[model samples]
Target: MARSGKDTDKRIKTGRGRTASQIRWLERQLNDPYVKQAKADRYRSRAAYKLIELDEKFGLLQNASRVVDLGIAPGGWAQVVRKKRPKAGIVGIDLLEVEPIEGVTILQMDFMDDAAPDALTEALDGPPDLVLSDMAANTVGHKQTDHLRTMGLVETAVDFAVQTLEPGGAFVAKVLAGGTDNELLKLLKANFTSVKHAKPPASRKGSSEWYVVAKGFKGRD
Candidate 1:
């Protein structure tokens, strides 16, 4: 709940821990491969690799598809989507401004805005073939508050998907690891052919984040 102080000195001494653990508290950026690859490819976040891994496992990104990316501030996922489909429709929305990336329509607005989804639809001309929501709230000192904020975002994203996802479309979003989002999980199973929870290799080991992917959307009333 409170930030992990499991490694606190005097409180918890090292007992022949692994090399990474030994120097973890003082570690600097020592060329994490995902970071290197992101720099090399000029993607926004090293988190791009998580999307790549998910795609490799599920082939979610398809040619000629329309995609909406929520909380795409750093734009790594947008970069991957554009590279994967040079001619596909891509719209990325975030609270912060982003330098333009080719083939993406960037909207500098909060996804929580009432008009946001409408604006996104206007940009896309219709429902999206895929919706990728990497939205995470800035954490407060309180873990329960942070979790609630994160779950709120996830719930909103799922509602948006239910309304605007095309039949057989996919919804991918970030979730916390302490508990599976129960109501969202149930909704996904009812409406999609498959719903899976995955923790990609690119996610930080210490982070509680994971991805929930619901695919093969069944159109709703």
Candidate 2:
């Protein structure tokens, strides 16, 4: 729908040497209401609205004391978390450097590294009450390959959540449209009281991304 640009309220003029896909993306960004709202609200990215919608539906940030944000680039979700739970300690990790947020501890490194879990835990005063992962593997274009790579990140995030979340805590991670695999679902059901998938209104209809929310951790023992 955004490709034509002419039909939208805002037009993205095609720039020189821009590929068709890039032109379409610019058109979509220009036409997207969330992008305009994000600018007005001063949120880092439109992804912030996804977390806000999820929080409203699920109460994910309620009573949270410490939070861990995976793939926290651009810091939109963390900003939301900080605003919703002002006193909560936040530790965020990403491969890219994020501009500092006042009360957050940011680690710039590979979250898949062996030391990452300890690093994140140590940054916070105690085990996290909420673990959020917005990580997605770099897409290689092949659908199956992309799905597996993203699922791999989800699986690892689950493992970290199970290992580090306090009892009764919650874990939320981005997953593909079909949602978590059967094995992952079984693992989540076994470890948490409830698990569900959600696609917030902020997520574009064309996007395959959905969130897997696993709540009420049963403890690691």
Candidate 3:
């Protein structure tokens, strides 16, 4: 079993078939405090703490009645929502399968599909008060290409939030280090009363991930 405390460094032997990068990842996981906390708290992944921390700072779940979670694989962020707001209706979509969560409706499909937006709205009783997207494109190792691909997902997510969110609703999505590009920033500012960026403490210091939080949806008038 892997332990996740930082009290002592854990070293793994260079076993056959294990690459150096894999070993480094394993060691890092072993030492991650949030991973240990997630295990103890029975949350799905260390990613749960990221949402928890964001919620603490932004109160994202405080008044949320209906929520849509994009890229909900491994079900960490959805788990946090469930714990924080048990009565909030949640619908999650991802390309990967997620284990059944007690109150969440999980959809295994590509969010890029034209059918996805309608399917998600139909699952909920009303317009979502919160829309969260942790989606990122699979990296092809080329920096510019990877950034563009991920930004494409972010843009789509923003469009969905704008089209479906209730007035006063909020949208939160993961973005790269430089934060949202200028055009996306302009779009968000035009449709939302407040827009800001943050990097939650649970995110690794070396990670390029930042979150853009847009609140007070101005409606699609």
Q: What stretches of model 2 exceed 4 Å from their correct place?
A: 1-8
Candidate 1 regions exceeding 4 Å error are 1-28
Off by over 4 Å in 3: 1-6
Decide which is better by TM-score, 1 or 3.
3
Better of 2 and 3 by TM-score: 3
**Native-structure RMSD, model 3:** 2.4
Mind giving the per-residue lDDT tens digits that candidate 3 earns over 108-218?
A: 999999999999999987899999999999999898999999999999999999999999999999999899999999999999999999999889999999999998999
lDDT of 2 by residue, 1-221 (tens): 02343544766665789888888888888788888788888899999999999999999998899999999999999999999899999999999999999899999999999999999999997999999999999999999999999999999999999999999999999999899999999999999999999999999999999999999999977
Report lDDT per candidate.
0.85, 0.93, 0.93
Candidate 1: RMSD to truth:
7.6
lDDT of 1 by residue, 1-221 (tens): 02233442332235465475555632423335566567777888788988999998888896438999999989999999998988779998999989999889999999999999999988987789899999999999698899999999999999998899999899999999854577778988999999999998888888799899889999987
**Candidate rank order under TM-score:** 3, 2, 1
Q: Cα miss at 121, model 1 (Å)?
A: 0.8
- Quick one: how many clashes does candidate 2 have? 0
Best by TM-score: 3
Worst 10 residues of 2 by lDDT: 1-10
